[model samples]
Target: MPDQPFSLDQLRIVLIGTSHPGNIGAVARAMKNMGLADLALVAPRCEVQTSESISRASGADALLVGSSLHESLDDAVADATLVVGASARSRTLPWPMISPRQLGAALPAELSRPEARVALVFGREDAGLTNAELQRCHRHVHIPTNTEFSSLNLAAAVQVLSYECRLAWLDAGDTAPARQTAMAKGTAPAGEAPFGEAPFGVEWDNPPASHADLERYFAHLERVLVAIGFHDPERPRQLMARLRRLYLRARPDSLEISILRGILTAIEKHTGRR
Candidate 1:
């Protein structure tokens, strides 16, 4: 437990079907790093307190001592009110996802609500939470990742979420909000200004694009739009805004956008050759 205790008494780190001893140990290290102390094991495939786990834990032995053993997940988090199942992809179970920041902001309210205890649940290394397992939790959390290659280590996921909860706990229950300043009348910046977006508005961090890339994207958009009958020479600007919106929505990753421009060049060549 942290000196100030940021979590509900029912807070538990439940690992289901964990097959690797080192991962369990790493999880202990991760939890301790973020000031979380409770751990629960559910149907683990290996010895939970092996030398590998202890060694990987680094210096989190105190938290490891109280690690609870459970034959099943239901026993592990049966008393928890808010159960967040960490996953990399969607499944049959429709668990709504909130980003780490959103989770941090919302968890304190959820944990403080009457009769609700918050618990963060992690799945095994080989396989994550099953539909049956996810149903036990009130909601699911998707860790956003590259769609093409979306895989993450189990312990790393625990580290991210535990950190979020700890932050939320600190922000919600802490009493010392204002600090004295050297000014005539002290006042702090509003709305946790430290985390807000750009004051003038977030422009392209990398200036909208050079003229060349912009023209290339326009040509690509024009080709695709004309092929789909979304554009006409008489009213070229009619679909310009809509085309821009498509690219904005796609957020066409660098590679995808580059490939799109290449195809546009190829198409222009073939059409002009006629």
Candidate 2:
């Protein structure tokens, strides 16, 4: 028997600082159309349940009604295991960037872990996510558009990513069963891989760290660095940002995070700063 199709229940569409109520409704519609249910709103600038929003939502009012609202992005995605932000512009500090198609291809394996919760974060209508916001994401996704008119609507962006996610889900459903059956019968080829394997065929010994876990680790790291005089908050030079990029790229698991935190504690004790 093949593995079950990835569940959209674990995938959340997060909109941050949305200024328009209609855009929120439209986003809800797009998510519902793609069979995605979890919608998180962070610091929405407009009233969530307005006539404009309901009108634009069409028949996706349920999503709007059930959406979770947060005061900050951190609270919105605190439990997510994978957080990917949609960025339209380039920054001085480049993040791990991937195309929309690549994001779709990667979802099946990412959502395979039972505890995994993936957050696809979108920014405001007028401007995108801030540098600080993008830094919090594990990866950044960009949708290539005609340079002549690259201004994609907020809801349209959500629709594009939502469609890609649906496509990946459908594709996984089509292939997973047959692959699992072959493996169960022991007729699979000598190194025949199963569906839903981790990206690049790497198997994890421990589950990936949650967003909260990474946040704690980052705080501990900065504290330890400051204690050792390696980082100076007064005259900082993007040291913490660079270090965050490095650790996020590593995608350390829970055990690794514990070990890293232990080292930080040891350093604090040695420096008598604890």
Candidate 3:
């Protein structure tokens, strides 16, 4: 069988509390243009199953028809291994923020996992996501806009993010064919596709850790920090914030996470947290 790209399928475009069904349909169209299909709605303010949505969807009605709906953001992204929330404005408490391009670059490797599910979450049109909703995401993606009038429509944001993701997927598939051919010398037959070189053909032995795994790790880390008198829950400074930035920036795989947790356990043993 020919190699199929599962990473694209692993991505979910999640719309939360979308006030306009037309925007939902427009988003469906945008996702379709970029070879993305999975769509999830979280507590949509308007009835998504309406004629207005169907009209706006153009030929991407299948996405709208098959899209799943949930009561809350948690439920919408319950099965997602990586969740990235899209926001236009800065928040009071800074989350691990990245540009859409950065997110696009990272997703190809992340979705290489066997059962990885990535959710690109977008919030309501009026106010965007609440502080509580934004906290649920592992990373925050900011779409850079004009400083003076930065009001971006919901569907337009989806289109921009979707385009970036498509480009990233293409980059992941791109190989250095000329370099491989030069190295092959006389061994390679005429017209034969050059073998992928270096990082291009490497397989992941340990899949990237899921969001659930990270959540558990964070909980354990918090407990350990509290036990070691490093992070006092009462008078919490930027210790946890700095740690979150460090870990999220690293984006550790499963084996790495296991090693980290093991080290934490060793610390716990010394701290008498049996």
Candidate 4:
């Protein structure tokens, strides 16, 4: 049987701390051009519906009007099963990084799961995503550009990624069944196919944990770690960050998260903190 074509609707474009109304409009235009409709604005500095934005959006004002507003990045992507942050530079701690094309190739299999939502997050125009913000993503997507002139406009960056996603969607519609079969059988032709990659290639019995679920687990884990005197809140090392990276890379499912939480509860009971 043929696999179902990946739906653009399963993907959402999240703009964090966007300062310019015009850029927001242009982003809407770019999304519409690529057949993507979901737009999330997190702590936007400018109004979503403005004359400048409408003018820049050209004919894509519907997207701007329908866009969801979020108070924080976490709120915006709380329900997303997969979150990929767009970053131009590397951080002190390395993250699982992939190129825009690789990201495009990976989306088909990712969106195949039931109720799975993927968020493509773009940061501010001036500074880009903060270290804390990037840490929330499961993967970081970097667009390879010339070292001498690597600066990219906000809307232009969105356009580039949006184009890649549309290309992937079209390709999946045509060859998903064969490609998926080959991947399941570990016979996919190598070279830029992103086949047999961690997280993407693995089959799951339970749905991948949502961003909200992971956040709650992290909070619970932190409390338990503190209760057990295993982690210090002040004058401490990067213990939490490292653990976060570990679990994010693992991409634990809902059932796994539940089990982990249960363990934390048992630890609290044993520690006499409950």
Q: Rate the local accuracy (lDDT) of all candidates.
A: 0.65, 0.88, 0.79, 0.89
- lDDT by residue (tens digit), candidate 1, 116-176: 4566888878788776566555456777777887788888888888887777777654632
Q: Which ten residues in a row have the lowest lDDT in candidate 1?
A: 193-202
Give the candidates in order of TM-score, highest first: 2, 4, 3, 1
Top candidate by TM-score? 2
lDDT by residue (tens digit), candidate 2, 1-274: 2445679898999999999999999999999999999999999998999999999999998999999999999999999988999999999998999999989988877888777899999999988999999999999999999988999999999999999998888888888877677767766555532233443334667878899999999999998888888999998799999998998888888899999999999888888999
TM-score for each of the candidates: 0.60, 0.93, 0.76, 0.91
Q: Score candidate 2 by lDDT.
A: 0.88
Residue pairs clashing in model 1 are: none
Off by over 4 Å in 4: 1-4, 177-203
- Compared with the true structure, model 1 gives a TM-score of 0.60
Clashing pairs in 4: none
Look at candidate 2 and give me any clashing residue pairs.
Answer: none
In the range 1-274, model 3's lDDT, one tens digit per residue, is: 2243346888999999999989999999999999999999998989886898999999899999999989987777866777899988787777888898988877655665558788999999999988767766888999889989898989999999999998877765563354345446643333422111123224556666666677678889999988888889988766666676677566677788899999999998987884
**Model 1 off-target regions past 4 Å?**
1-10, 113-115, 173-274
